[model samples]
Target: MAGSNFVSEIFLFPLSGKIAPILAMATEIKAEPAMVLAGVLLSLVAIYIASKAGGEFFNWLGFPPVLGELVGGVVIGISALNLVIFPENGVDSSASIIVKMLELTAGLAPDAAEVTFQAQSEVLEVLAEIGVIILLFEIGLESNIKDLMQVGVQSLVVATVGVTLPFVAGTAGMMGIFHVSAVPAIFAGAALTATSIGITSRVLTEINRLNTKEGQIILGAAVIDDVMGIIILAVVASLAKTGEVDIINAVYLIVSASVFLVGAVLLGRFFNDTFIFFAEKFKTRGRAVIPALTIALFMSYVGAAIHLEAILGAFAAGLVLDNLHETEVGRELEKLILPISDVLVPIFFVTVGAKTNLGVLNPAVPANREGLVIAIFLIVVAIVGKVACGFSVFGLGNVNRLAIGVGMVPRGEVGLVFAAVGSASGALSPALDVAIILMVIITTFLAPPLLRVVFGEGEPEAEEVPETSG
Candidate 1:
């Protein structure tokens, strides 16, 4: 009975002062049926606010706003301040959101809390998944299919080498040094497979060097890197789900992923023309952006249908678009997609942050001390792996090797997605999960500042080395 009252106190009121006093009082005494609904609403509102505030603060401090979002989650999450109890384990009161909710119900029913958590988790997953799809789709919109091929032979080599090195180091380090199981190690390596183009490109743009050969190479490599990472993600995700990585199944995944990406871009061309034709006709009838969004959603399903990741389909859909800016309808569709992406994308990041159990990093705790060590090792591999890409170029002409490498260091959103996939796939152990999250946070925090310093004004530029086919 005491526990029940304690739970009610936590949930029945707002966490920070977002609500009026009157509303808080009324919500606390609301009848039984309305209790659950109020709790969910409170969670959503609190999470979103925390996420936005975190993002803004990080952005102001010269870091990616996403880092702030993750911080916000940690601050409210049980791992840090314990301000909010989105518990990691229900049996242990320390981590269960459901157990907290159960306290509010008069009967102290675990079933009620369990049911609510399952429902809430499902909804958040769908929404988070959608946000990631939109994120990849936005990345795709930045270039045409030809851009993938246009990243010079050197860029392609760099991307390939970059991804290969990290996977090997991550897997070997986890197994040998950390004594981790193979599956979890594979997930760790897979998480490091992509460079955050958003971070790298921003620094280049800020310094007016985006068009430089070094910058171009980084951009090209980033694109190829994302494709490689997503394909790897699909394969590893399959391995985690099946509990065994069959050779035949691995080959099949590779083939399917490749075909899906290439085929989608090719087929999407025809669909784009057809879509535009109809969109133009219906422009006056207010059916403008439907075709664009519908295609993206449809392709997302197609990806999952064929055993490829849904983001791959969303990417394919974005590639299918021919820059809908020529016609009125096309212009409208572009505007419509951005706002939707903005709204949905933050929810995913905030949730990822909130789920990170920071308590695992405490050196005073024996198990967590080990986790901190693993996190440090993983962080090293993630940085060195991508930084090595700077050297993959055969010709170095005025390219600052350190800058190019540092630019690739930020894992950003993609790493978050990879970790989320592992968690949802039930492939990650709690220790491993915390390690990956730490890696993500560190990488995300490091890149922007490093890039600004490396490429800051008046820095001496290295002379370009003549091109050689490596």
Candidate 2:
């Protein structure tokens, strides 16, 4: 679950100071409420600018707009221009252009700079979390629950194979080849098991394949992958703390996640009617979307409460409401959500890019040299491990197996979550952590273009409209 909790857990360090101090006043200027608000506004300016510029540039280059947003984030983030940065170990808050701007214009004292930056960054982090939840909810809305059901078995196989192969291969190789300790090796392997549903789904939607058999299979598998990933995360985190796994906690997570997802979907039939009932009676503006958004948020909350990713609940909520496609409310819901999605979704991708610290890639650092080598090995495993999932399909004739495999390639934020958790727990060495980050970055950027190739870059065929009854 890439919830707010995870966001807080990951950014333990402050941003590196980029701009020199301009004020040395004896009286420390406290960061007032207005000062914090100013900082947040500045950060939003940087975020939207990065999102638009990157998205536009990438679209022109014949790539996914999401890819460009990520690049834009990297360009402005700690990796490049330092316009937006997060709290990280051994970094200066002064490095944030947002912070600097606030200091100069808002009279933010040097002493309160870090606090203001932290507060501003936290807001971004929460927004990013919400962005992803909205992304998943949007995906769920687009998907057909019945179609997903049809491919459930194949998806389960693909997800199982995807998780097992990467976990086993990565863990064994780390221990056997690099002589890494068992716990860290397991943690790294767990990181490799993640397949970013958001990144892959966005690409599929871009190519107009989200409803295709191959697309449905990939979407179903990615959801399964998330459930499995959470279970794996729980296990590894426990191992990190105590040199052994906690079987009971692992079992509990597995059971709760399964029940939550199944329960949400089964109850969606009930929800569909309830949603329409409330929507029709409201007659006010936002009637359809407001009720729908309420469901998404509630489902997300339920998922989070159950120790699963809140996105799961949101996705499930979307699936529950899938039947609404036949109704006027359903059609209105989609139209309304798109505008909101346009604004929030980019924030998630950009923040993922910004949070990525590229300093680990520099070979000039003696410690990074070994990590680079490890990173190469991990990257290969990460790609090959998920790519192999395409072959796991059964009973489906003429399925685009390679596309399925390639679709699973990008690790995106999910992989980052694993890396962050492992690093925080002291289960990963610096080199190993760097290697995982690189693996995530490469696979994430690599998969979208590869998907475009495998699926063919021609104009997508017009979609078949779902049958509707008055």
Pick by lDDT: which candidate is best? 2
Worst 10 contiguous positions by lDDT, candidate 1: 9-18
List TM-score per model, in order: 0.73, 0.92
Candidate 1's residue-wise lDDT over 89-189, tens digit each?
Answer: 23233255533645664354453444444334445555767887776666555444553444468778888888999999999999898888888899999
lDDT (CA) per prediction: 0.67, 0.85
Candidate 2 per-residue lDDT over residues 328-439, each given as its tens digit: 9999999999999999998899988888778989999988999999999999999898889899899977678899999999999999888877887877888888899899
The TM-score of predicted model 2 comes to 0.92
- For model 1, the local distance difference test gives 0.67
How good is model 1 by TM-score?
Answer: 0.73
